[model samples]
Target chain A: MNSPLLDVRDLVVRYGPVTAVDRLSFTLDAGETLALNGPSGCGKSSTALAVLRLRRPDGGKVRFEGRELTNLTERELRPLRPRMQPVFQDPYGSLSPRHRIRDAVAEPLKVQGTWNRTDGPARVAELLDRVGLDPSYGDRRPHELSGGQCQRAGIARALASRPQLLVLDEPVSALDASVRAGVLNLLSDLQDDLGLGYLFICHDRAVVRHFADRVVEMRDGRAVPA
Target chain B: MSSEALLSVRDLRVAFGPVEAVRGLSFDVRAREVFALVGESGAGKSLTARALLGMVPRGATTGGRVRLRGSADLAAERGRRITLVPQDALSALSPVHPVGDQLAAAVRSVRRLSRGQARARAVAALDRVGIPDAARRARAYPHEYSGGMRQRAVIAMATVNEPDVVVADEPTTALDEERREQVLRVLAEQREAVGAALVLVTHDLEVVREHADRVLVMYAGRAAEVGPSGHVLGRPRAPYTAGLLASLPQDGPRRHRLPALPGTPPAPDALGPGCAFAPRCPLATAPCRDHEPEARTVDGRLVACHHADDLSDPLREFV
Candidate 1:
């Protein structure tokens, strides 16, 4: 069998006296989806943040592609950031309201210094089409699009650098039921095509049951493998 | 007009200047039944709830008849006969006052009860909704209660006066699955105890299927389908309703791909003369694009699609 894309071991996160996440351990193989399922205040979100190194963990190791991310400095982590990206809960907050859809999608490519100003538009359009958005959607601002459209744009933006693993934090929770299924389908298809791994954090059991290959239940900041 | 209908809305229209949010919507809520208004974000589900509670925003014009039982005017029956269980329990309950005081105020609104009597009723209401330590919890401030408990408090407040109709707008949207079930059970129990009709405005189809007795599906400010929950969800006729059900992720073996409706719901301002669902409907034909289809009763369900007659169960393949 191939090596896992993400390996998180004994992860712990704390907010002063409160332990948000406690001794969490999980591994995700390439093209696999691992859903962290639990109720509110279960520390599922804290685990996601810690694994991404967006929030510093209190203890334990997070390894992406066999590299130890926990000990990496800010400067070293910046270059490795593109390999793992986050699709946040709220699309409205995740995407810049001021930036056009094209700019938002191309921002990642620009930040990673992979594409120049001249090469950005074509790549942005390609990404938009891949996420099921029309090329014309590139011209519109984030506010102009619907929640599902905005989320598709968000996915396009996340995929700009072709991340190997996507940390989805309640990705479709903010969307309406009518369109949420479409976005979930898009995510599932994207995973299949790219052979990417997903560390999905969600509270809804029905969604978790359908999406995840394996489930990890979190209770009071502790991971209970299901 | 059905004699059993506790509340009947006829030709309701809510317009904000040039943009019409709800256009000519009509439905009926039977006594002790959960009538769900299911739709997308801009489909005017919340606006209908506001209209039912007589709380439409200022500058928006509302025209229609909201008859409570046999009475035509909803203005007189607003607070006494109808109440609202708002979306956010945190914001719905006043932050400064204790939960008991908030509920007591609601109790005093309809009945000319003494202050002590109202307070006693408020505590009883809280207890009835399954809030533990009702007396102590009632005296506690809104911030002190957990999210689930706060929601139970909100339900208790709405049902304090025993209003004939209770309108709950996405009541469990902010809650987790466990809490969501708790809140739903409390709401159901309270509605049953009061024997009041419930108008539930939500985007969650799972909730509708589980709780609702009847359903009205709104697409782009128009009623797409209206029928019993079993018929609409089990054997949906309208393409929009069918597409929505087919899209939900199932719990069996993993799907190769989730069934999805391609396009998003059209904006109210961008609406055309044709059926609102025609653009995304898999079964759309030329007749669906020219003019809107009238509501046709088929097998005891009202479906407003030209091709609804020809359409099979949309969820057949998914199931």
Candidate 2:
């Protein structure tokens, strides 16, 4: 299926004597959303971390667009970090407290050295606008925005580097039900517009049914048949 | 309200300094029925639950009547007749002690049982909630059990006393569908077995539909709509209720843009002289902005919306 954008093969993550994720394998195609549904501590978050190489796995392989990423060093993985950005569960925790919304969205672009001094603010405004936030919100701090707005800013930051795949770990679980709907619609629209792949980890069944093209249910660190 | 309801809350108000977190909320929960309080984060659902448990924040002041089984003094009868199943089970449980000890302690508080009998009852409670090898698992600590299992243990503890009212606040929000269903079913079964009324506070409309016998939709710390689950959910009489149902994602086929309510719920302290939802209400008029809508009976349902007459059932697509 067009050489899946993010391919994980038999991924294993362990903590001390316990295996948090056991021999899990999955693939994501461009413009496709894959939801990992499970209860808490069913290894959903561990699997996401292992794929991004944020947490080193005990065994197995994680490939990004056909390149093996398991044995890669942190310095070596830095070049590919922008291509697979993360939108975490807690928007407040994931974002920096001191940075303004503009800087938060522009930080990724600055890291890639892609935008010039003159073009950075325009790109930040464009990104914020893309996520359904007013450009004026760029001046506000993270604490000033509501849970929904902060999450939108988080999405804008994830898209700043033009990532091909978004590893969203419970992105909407922190927001209210009404606010979550808007964010989900924004994610769906962004996927259609940018042809992005999503590894959505969620516990809400109704959300999985509505948002994901395919559902993988995790139980006791293994993917079980649904 | 039923004449012989188990728990009757009349004009319950919780105020933290100048802000009234729960403003004049009232409801009745019948024995063995699941009563769900549905709303957003700041809608006072949690606050109302806390008031019932007599655990409102230190500075918050609660007023009006909270009669449990005809007793007006809720604080005097907190643990004896009513108990809380907290949202975060991991924190709700003691980290250092075995789960069995904690459950036994809760059981011993209400019933005059021997230590051995309480422990046996604790194991039985754990078994009732579908925990495998309950006798062995009861010896495990909170951190040792899985999140779902910890929640089950919390449920076991809450119902062990056989209280007349069980207040479960967001019990399944942290669980997935399979585990959520498992915990929900276990709680329902346990409540039924014990002959207790369940006061469920959650933001999930789908769960409310599946489990609740009656529902109270709160907006800005007020009851926006109150009725049977089918009528309130199937035919939302209030604009805010209609908007909340419309905002949920459907089961299949993604819409281009979900129909979202434009703004956030008003802060408790910033509510003006009109309906708290009028600013975000699509059908808001001068009357809605100028005067607060009092609760009125319409078609056998209690609704607090000035434009309730113009609003129609918005759950046709939802169901």
Candidate 3:
């Protein structure tokens, strides 16, 4: 319908001689949620990684807001980096154990020069509040919090840059059932409030059915639309 | 239990020294019927499956009885009697061994099926699990097959003997939505063909809703709720069950918020005096916190909660 916020066309991802994604194409509208569903190794995760240029695709085109992402150099990619953020599958792995909540959330703002040196703490506190965490949690290290808390911190960090696109890789896979529901609810609420687009990666159809505006099924590196 | 039940777990319990993983859980799994256990991690869903095939780790305290209802001499014959199709297909398979040899070992462990017989059966099993080129794939190593295909191989190995019960612990955890459905459908069909009961252990409500005939909801090392899958999942009588049912997101139309259960589930060993869920439950009462509630039949399910009646509030939606 509307011009997509993220568009992928006839893309192919390969691992050595083997082609992982064979001519796959998909598009995500701005502020909309798109779920990539398929068997493990069917190229759903690869497709997500490729959009952020994390994984180099052998063939196809990826356009973000009509700008071709594959053509951008690292230096050229800097400005748009703030508009795209990721929270990976394993929260413990995605978050730095050594970093405190404030520091982690402030890390992106610091990199983007959004919050100047003295105001970083204030920015971090605001982020913590937005994600439903108390300001006291800002002092706690990633290890001090539970899995669900760490995930919330990860979300806070993702929001620190005020990104237009959020790539959530199995965001709640590691959390308990009760906790997962909370996180999913948080994501949807955030999307509604911020007009954000999500590329939600998950194997759980139940989770996808609950959250995503549209569903895409990937198989053997091909986009199997449903 | 009827003779058609493939696996009968009677008060089965497994304790790891100080921690009791499973606290006397019991259920009957009938042939061609899929029985699902849905709960968060550490709820002892996986441990119960391990006990069915005597696979609980050595020295782990195990109590209660397990009987193969219709099958003869399952304890005497493991590989042939009842089998587990492990969750992680890649790790479950040996990288060093060819898929064919691995399948053969599975068959060899159960009975004196000839090498050729095992090969044929393996191919057939593979075919049954929806994998093409079964013969060619048999010669391939575990690494050669895709993750979905590897899972199929694991299923083939488990089904080669045509076991009476197949334990699939989160079998679709690693699969995508379409592939996950494919695998689940294959399991359903394979169970039908082999005349076996399928025990699917997962935390996924959708999987339980679509596939299982019966649902066993676990909490704090006990069956907090057990009954027909539809009834327990849809009109959950237990507070914990209601919370789980409430928290899940639905398709078609989005809701204002998912009603999340407030707190984390308790560790199996450190259960509260009253209800394990009382600490997190929105409708917890004085008795719910003072004493642990025993399971009672309400609307067919055996639910363990004094405030089970409070779960009557209509849940949000299901997509």
lDDT of 2 at B308: 76
Candidate 3: stretches off by over 4 Å: A1-47, A55-72, A112-118, A136-145, A173-177, A201-210, A213-225, B1-6, B69-75, B113-120, B127-136, B309-319
Which 10-residue window in model 2 chain A sums to the lowest lDDT?
A1-10
Per-residue lDDT of model 3, residues A1-226, tens digit only: 5678899899888889888889877788877999987767778788878888888778889999878988789899899988888889888788888888888888887787787867778888888888878889999998777788889989999999989999998899888778987888889889989999999988777678778878888778877765
> Of the pair 1 and 3, which is ahead by lDDT?
1
Task: Score each candidate by Cα lDDT.
Answer: 0.88, 0.89, 0.82
Best by DockQ: 1
**Tens digit per residue, CA lDDT, model 3, B220-318:** 778888899989887877877877877776654654567787767777767767877788876778998999888788888788888666556434321
Worst 10 residues of 3 chain B by lDDT: B310-319
Q: Give the Cα error of residue A207 in candidate 2, in Å.
A: 1.7
Number of the candidate with higher DockQ, 1 or 2 = 1
For residues B1-319, could you state the per-residue lDDT of candidate 1 as single tens digits?
A: 3777788888899999999989988888888889999998889999989988788999988988778885667777776788899999898988999999988988887789999999999999999988898989888999999888888899988888888899999998868988888889999999999988899989888999999999999988889999999989988888888888878877667745677777788888888888888898777789889899989898679989897766576556333
Question: How far off is each candidate at the interface, as Cα RMSD in Å?
Answer: 1.3, 1.8, 2.3
Candidate 1 lDDT for residue A161: 91
Better of 2 and 3 by lDDT: 2
Predictions ranked by lDDT, top down?
A: 2, 1, 3
Best by TM-score: 1
DockQ-better candidate, 2 vs 3: 2
Where does the lowest 10-residue lDDT sum fall in candidate 2 chain B? B310-319
Q: What is the TM-score of chain A alone in each candidate?
A: 0.97, 0.97, 0.96
